[model samples]
Target: MGSDGTTAEVRCVAAVPCWVSLMAHDLDVAKAFYGPLLGWEFEPGPDRFGPYVHAVTGGEAVAGLGAASGGWGMPVAWTSYFGTESADAAADAVRERGATLAVGPLSFDAGRVAFAADPAGAVFGIWEGPLGRARRLDLLGAPVWIELRTPDPFAAALFYGEVFRWDGRDPERFEVRWEHDRVVLRAEGHSVAALAREQAGGPAGLPPHWEVSFAVEDTDAALIRAEELGGTALGPAFDSPYGRVARLQDREGGRFAVISAKP
Candidate 1:
């Protein structure tokens, strides 16, 4: 990344990174959803890989907007891939270790990227960009968390547990937990997200999905900004035992969260 480039805050891994790609059914629709929700700025780019909208947060590319294809009969939503040192090497190592390969060791000069699923079936991405930055915080707090809602929690736990060398375990709620949750991970070497298995036949619209958490100074302010801007409030802003969160769908179908940890 050029110093003159928009990604100037390379120093604050504590703030936002560039944009995340939201996979949606329609390009403009997706943009409509996010444009105001997160208070993002979009840049025009070639329509090769997607209508390929560059969503700007804080004057830099914060997330991406793209049209979706088949990955299952799934519609619109956002998912993520981790940034790796050598995506090819990471993909090869994961595959050799029994993980299933989905995409490629192929290169993207923009970054070295690949897609794959862990033993438990949760997917993640890897990219060591030209700047070599992994996760950055913008309006979304550097993707502070990742949650996988899968049918078989234990199975998914066992798979990723071995693959990521994660300590997988279950603890009943309110028992004084140390980031206690299934599928625990360290974001930038700090504890970030956890995983949990959904009960069989759990309520509507829930499937094996990954939920990402971004940072916000005030969830209420962000929520107001989101609605006033044109994003859909998929769920009401709520407080959990964990943190304050508001779920949203950008113009298309890319859903992500803006969270603020309560002291």
Candidate 2:
């Protein structure tokens, strides 16, 4: 049991994004930037990994912050973890499907985790453990959705389908509509995540990556606080069918979003 009486049961179905973690080039800057914006409180992670910090909101572990070491060469970004019954099996499936395994199906005090990149070069994770279900979208600071920005949405959908068994729209039916061209993934009839085609005339030099959005009470207020805390508002808040949304880049250049969904 956790300090909040939350059990570490795996509630999410297989292939659904269950957790979101940030790899920070500077942990201290990350704490300062996110703490005020999301009202997240930090706690030391499992004893084995000393530098890992778990982002807690309402006593629930919502996300994580870990130091990015040398040789990682990757930008500071949020990586989404999909739930799996067996990390080892998932890792094997990723390899067999032509995706590259970046890290381990190794175990820790909390659970088993492995990192991988799809054939299209978008990185993601697989997790199997007691705390795999620790995050809930209903929570104030929890991730409401994750979006994969890639140049090849069809290829990404097919790659993830083979690796994670995701049920997405048929490739033959794909169409780029609206401002954002994306395909939604569903598990057990519930929308889990999305695969988006890279937008034209957007920021240059941005690589294919997963973007995590947190649920907030007010998108406008969150964007204000983000700038005050050394982060930058990538764009003004805009209303959508789902909610008021805004994109933001942290002090360390990690990009994310905040949304206030319509009830």
Candidate 3:
């Protein structure tokens, strides 16, 4: 199991494809938020239902985007799902770790998926790709980055280390790393992962949730669009060493990011 009690192998898988399943409160509003912000083009679902967002990077369908309806927690934020080879096996590993099963490893018409909460309380998705996934590492773009914030960095590392068996760089920033890449659960400041872990932890703290981000040409303009779209700005826009950032939440209560960075 992963350190948080999900599939360690799945979590550790390198080059795991990322796909965002947006559960938006208002589809039209979300379209407005992303269309101009990310320059995405809308297309039919092929067989999926409603409209599927075609994420373009140099004008290619690198990923799929779609609005989620229902669920009281639905909001206009991006939710990240990692690609796995076997949903059932991954789910089994997660269960073995004493994790909470929120949804299915069950079959969807399109694919197989399951939802679970880690020991840190961050909720994540596991997807078994029946067909395929996207083709990009795609930094400096929409929601291309992820950061983990955990209370017990060592515990977090131990959990994840067991799951993915990933090993990597000695972080200049975080404590431990997977494949020497991202410092697993070792961030000191505020980060999307930290925020999610806090949220997932609950009332006294923040709930763990994915903070989906969008590519914006102007952070101020994106914040303006956020207000117009019935999405609220969670905090002031700040400049990260990496870039400029603003936090946001939509009507249904999903949180995400809008970032503008220097070229």
Q: Per-residue lDDT tens digits of candidate 3, residues 84-196?
A: 66677767777777777688887644468788766776667777754332333343344544544445545544554444333452343234433333343332222222222
Worst 10 residues of 2 by lDDT: 170-179
- Give the Cα lDDT of each candidate: 0.57, 0.75, 0.53
Better of 1 and 3 by lDDT: 1
**TM-scores, all models, native as reference:** 0.69, 0.82, 0.68
Candidate 2: segments with Cα more than 4 A from true spot? 1-13, 47-50, 69-73, 131-136, 167-181, 187-190, 199-205
Give me the runs in candidate 1 sitting further than 4 Å from their true place: 1-19, 44-48, 68-74, 131-142, 151-178, 187-189, 199-204, 220-235, 250-252
Q: Which stretches of candidate 3 lie over 4 Å from their true place?
A: 1-17, 46-57, 62-77, 108-110, 130-141, 165-205
Estimate, for each residue in 1-263, the C-alpha lDDT of model 2 and write its tens digit: 64433343323345667788888887888998898899888877753443677887876777888885555667788889987778898899999988899999878766788999888677888988653322455678878778788888888777777676544533332222323356776443334468888853346346787878898998999999999899999878988655788989999888898988777
Please say which candidate is ahead in TM-score: 2 or 3: 2
Q: Write the per-residue lDDT of candidate 1 for residues 1-263, one digit (tens) a residue.
A: 43323343322121112224566777777666566555666666434454566666665565666774444355666656554445666677678878778887665435555667766555666555544333443345345556666777667655544443333222221111135446454445444556666653353265466677667777878877777766667777888545788877554445678887776
Best by lDDT: 2
Summed over model 2, clashes come to 0
Better model by lDDT: candidate 2 vs candidate 3 = 2
Candidate 2 TM-score over all chains jointly: 0.82
